[model samples]
Target: DAGVTQSPTHLIKTRGQQVTLRCSPKSGHDTVSWYQQALGQGPQFIFQYYEEEERQRGNFPDRFSGHQFPNYSSELNVNALLLGDSALYLCASTAGGKGHAPAKNIQYFGAGTRLSVL
Candidate 1:
């Protein structure tokens, strides 16, 4: 089965510009989450999408938004980007079922799209 995948592998942008990143969830999965990983910092959850709705979100500005399609793929859009936005944008997928089981609720991540804002 196919796993989560992200696009552009790498990206470069300037301050005040906008950027969009894409993601494909793992097979038989319906949940996708986006995360931001700075050079030396752990990944910080941006948001999670399930059934085309955001089910959970982390501490982030309004500049960060996302969408999930019926195909179970997702896209993250950032408006008025900042140099601080430079980081690795990771996409995670999980089979949303039986949430009571920790193993069944685990998330799988992709290599991520590296965004560099100058």
Candidate 2:
């Protein structure tokens, strides 16, 4: 009955370092989305995954990547990190796929992982 969950609640890294953030979706949810939120700014969409495949992506550079597992868990990987990448990374899950109405795809979010790059 737990909602979406993310790990390593906080992290610190240097420029050019790589980081991986993890998330487990809520029960019965098969889709996941990743977002980055900077201070005083709204969350920016990164990408979405369904059926273990990336279904959509935002304007982020190739340094951002992700994967969805069979169990609906997901991992967001960022490579060659930059100072601008410092932010709160959020994970959201919702029931998705065919036959589900767009309105029903109400996303449930996790507490998020805060990453800081120096």
Candidate 3:
């Protein structure tokens, strides 16, 4: 398995629209992280989920939301999107355990979903 996979490799939307992206984590991974990467920029953290709950979040607005299922798959939802929201949405998976520091957990990334908003 490729560790992580995302659906709708490419998507197109207009301003004020909403979008949903899906992700499936690798086997044995219990944590999921979402990121946004703009052209010529590094991936920006959006949030992290563990045990079907949001554990950490970045400096994004409430329009960005996500949910994790018991199976560890996740979906990221962006509402009322703007042109600036056009970017690559990335999904990463890692293992979570007692005494395991977040920074120490190795994250495996998916190819990412490219979103274009006009």
Estimate every model's Cα lDDT from 0 to 1: 0.93, 0.95, 0.93
Q: In candidate 2, where is summed lDDT lowest over 10 consecutive residues?
A: 96-105
lDDT of 1: 0.93
Give TM per candidate. Answer: 0.95, 0.96, 0.93
Worst 10 residues of 3 by lDDT: 95-104
Model 1: per-residue lDDT, tens digit, 5-113? 9998999999999999999988888899999999999999999999999999999999999999999899999999999999999999998753556766899999999
Off by over 4 Å in 2: none
Q: What is the per-residue lDDT of model 2 for residues 55-115, given as tens digits with 9 covering 90 to 100?
A: 9999999999999999999999999999999999999998886345774588999999999
State how far residue 24 of model 3 sits from its true place (Å): 0.3
Any residue pairs clashing in model 1, and if so which?
Answer: none
What ranges in model 1 sit over 4 Å off? 98-100
Cα-lDDT of candidate 2: 0.95
